[model samples]
Target: MSKSLTYTLLFLIMMIWGFNVIAIKILVESFAPVTITALRILLAGIVVMLILGIRKEFRKVTKPQLIYITIGALTGILGHHFFLSVGLTGTNASNAGLILGLVPLMTALAAILFLGDKLTILRMIGIVSGLIGVSFIVLNGERSVGSISRGDLYIFLAVVTQAVSFIAIKRATETMDARLMTGWMQIVGAFFLFVVSSRLEPDGLSTLTTGTPVDWIVFLASAILATGIGHMVYNKAIHQIGAGETAIFINLTPFFSLTGSYLFLGERIMVEQLFGFLFIVAGVLLGTGALEQSLRKHKQKRMAS
Candidate 1:
């Protein structure tokens, strides 16, 4: 319940999410994007259903809640995974890492516009900083203008869809249990992916047929640990605290993504990219009131002594 503890939870959730991106990229290489996304969510959904079923929670769902959950699954789980996987196919891992840094800013903007939350000057600055960070990453890559990679555009599409889903979840949370909502959403979304993947992917079933022990570990970690449990913790954290503070936790994603990419994929980070990463972190910290609060607390302690 303490602010410090809440922040720590948020940070851990972000690390899980960051690692997930790297895991997703690996899956994309070995499997069709849609196929992997579908299977992961479907498996996660089954796990969630089992958990809820044990608690007799599955029987309480009403008609309207079902509809809302369906929409949530489509927008957040389905659309988000589909676009992100599609994007990862065309873009470098580094670019995907950086582009995701904009989530907090986008979430804030969506909250303000759709959820009637106030957008303060600090958040405005954070939005600008995030945009600048996005620009730096895009330009630093020296990507072709006319022949922009399909992957990069897909990343942006993922962002837009995710923003919509976050706002929807925020509104839906007023009446629904976050866990139940998330579980159903994943189930419905997974079904959609399963159907689509079945048609587009030949030998798609084979992708999951064989893998090294490490591969299987990472895949389960991605689906169960990073996603199923990760989202549960995240929604809880955000529900306890406010979204602004929770959004700051997302700043950790790029750092984790970069580290995971390096250790797993052997990707090297350039100096410019590192600087951009720092700026993104700073922007998120400042935008979320974390930096300011820390400074204020430090100054107060100094003056008291």
Candidate 2:
């Protein structure tokens, strides 16, 4: 495929993931965070395995690769996404969206510390600016957890964990097919979440059975479309585009999530959210080289014409 087509497809994948943040928040209203996340992963993992298995590439995983896949699943699927869902239970959709913007910064930090990737001064500024914007959203927003927001710290932890997971994927990408790696990771992560839920929330399965049709639809969307397809696309994007570029698309997630929340969940956007969105957009535009790319593209088109 052409570069533009590849980037466009990846952009759409990222956009889908933004919608998922809202879907997951909706799912959490009816299910506990871990239970909801676990179920989604389990269902999505099954679908991914079936897809991979049909291609005859599913059984070729080596022992070391399996270990990496397990680790990746533990961090990315279990640690990151589960906590994110739980965090949504206490945070506003827009607040969560703002926090989600930090994924790229977190990824860049993880890359520098763990993956030995470049950490330019401009990148540091972008990361800090995004963090500052998130802080404004959190401090002024109504989310509170017993003197603190319930998911504030948890969601932050989730962001950090996801950053680490991104780096882990980057490392694994050197040796693994992004598809197989993601499929196995989700499968293994779902298993771990199942075990965790069994020990911690034994009532989870009962909750699933008790939910309404809307709940079921939300869960399925979260699992099948959001977690399965979205995450798979994310893994591929990271593999091909590298974490920094892939991470840039994440900044768009808050915009999609906020819009989804407003349309579906009856949530209203606040001034703080609007400002946060602007700062985040500006930061991301700088971080992703979008402004420069646009200008260059525009100049080329004009010159050509």
Candidate 3:
């Protein structure tokens, strides 16, 4: 794909994901979080499988790739979704969106620790800024003064699990296609979610039947557009453009999430949250090397001129 088209596609994908946070928040008001997550992920997995079947791109996984893929399924799919769903029960969608902005910073650190990537001074500064930004969001919860919110903590855990999952996914996709890995990971993760929901939420399955038509529409759209095809396109971007470049676009997600939350969920945007977002944007640009790369390109262009 041309660079402009690739960027445009990624921008749209981020918008879909941003709105997905609102979708989940709305769904959790009626359905049990874990149960709903299980159903959504299962449907998304089915969508991916159908796509793979139509394209004839499904391939058998070797033993080593299976190990990494399984790890990714557990952490990325099951763990991340589990925490995020539960977290949204207590936190506003606005806060949850800002907390998720930590993923790129955390993922960069994970790459350094797990993948033998270099740690630069800029990255160190970015990491500190990101953590400070998240602290503002977490501590500014709707509770007692200076007390951290449990919901914020769960969202942070979700970020941690997702970062770790990226490491496993990076390894798994070394030889395997990213789409195949995503399909298997989501399917396996959905299975585990089902088991967990069955154990902890015995009445959860019944709630699904009670949803209104509008609720079901939102649910299906979140599953199909946000989780299924969104992830597939994101993984493809990571494959084609490299992880660092792909991650820079993630900075756009929280802004979209903030807008969606304000418009759809009627959530207020706090000043502290806005400050947190500014720090996060700077951190991601620096952490992902996008700022450095941009400067380098501009300098080269100036010299050429």
Candidate 4:
């Protein structure tokens, strides 16, 4: 594909992921975090299964892969989204969006620690700096803020769970079909979420009925468009352009989320949050070696010229 088309598609995927935060915030206004996350994952899993069946891609799993998928469900879906869903209750969607920019760096750190990946001085610095940034923004320069609202802390921990899941997923997908693995993981995660939410929330799935049409619209849009379609297109883009090039677009997610939140929710952020977010973004770029890669290309072009 042309670079232009590739970038467009990539940005579109990021946009979906970014704006989904707003959708989640809307859902949280009425629905419990676990309830929305539960229903969303379950519905999205069903959608993915249907698509997989239509494409003749759905298949049975082995015993070992099942265990791996179960682990993935726990870390990726159960713990990750559960924390994120609950976290949004106390935090602004825009700041939560920015927190996601730490994924690349956190994922890199996870790989280094768990997968025996090497880390360099520059990358380490990036990781440390990124941590400081996340702390600054999440803490908002007040140690008391941590007590006032755990939304930031919950969201930060959600990323940690997600990063850990990436390692498990990497190991599991070595022999498994990526699509099948993802679909099954969602199914498993959704099942657990359903059970947990049903038990904890006395309403027991009544949240769906209690909501208005607009709520339903937002819920379905988030599940189908943001989670399902977004995942498919992102995986496709990664295959097309390679993971390295694809990652550059993810940084745009926070910007899109910020814009959407401001327009739709009339949300505003503190200057400290922006600074911390930039620190996280810069750290991610540096730790992932994306910054160095860009600089190398620019230098090469300059010398050639």
- Strongest candidate by lDDT: 3
- TM-score of every candidate: 0.87, 0.87, 0.95, 0.92
Candidate 4 lDDT tens digits, 130-229: 8888777776645565364688788888899988987888788788766677788888999988888877776856766788999999999999988876
Cα misplacement distance, residue 288 of candidate 1 (Å): 5.6
Off by over 4 Å in 4: 1-3, 141-148, 293-305
Give the local distance difference test score of model 4.
Answer: 0.82
Candidate 3 total steric clashes = 0
State the lDDT of candidate 2 residue by residue for 135-157, as single tens digits: 66776656443465767667888
lDDT of each: 0.77, 0.75, 0.89, 0.82
Q: RMSD, each candidate, Å?
A: 3.3, 3.4, 1.7, 2.3
Q: How well does candidate 4 match the true structure, expressed as C-alpha RMSD?
A: 2.3
| Candidate 3 local Cα displacement, residue 87, angstroms | 0.5
Ranking by lDDT: 3, 4, 1, 2
For model 3, the local distance difference test gives: 0.89
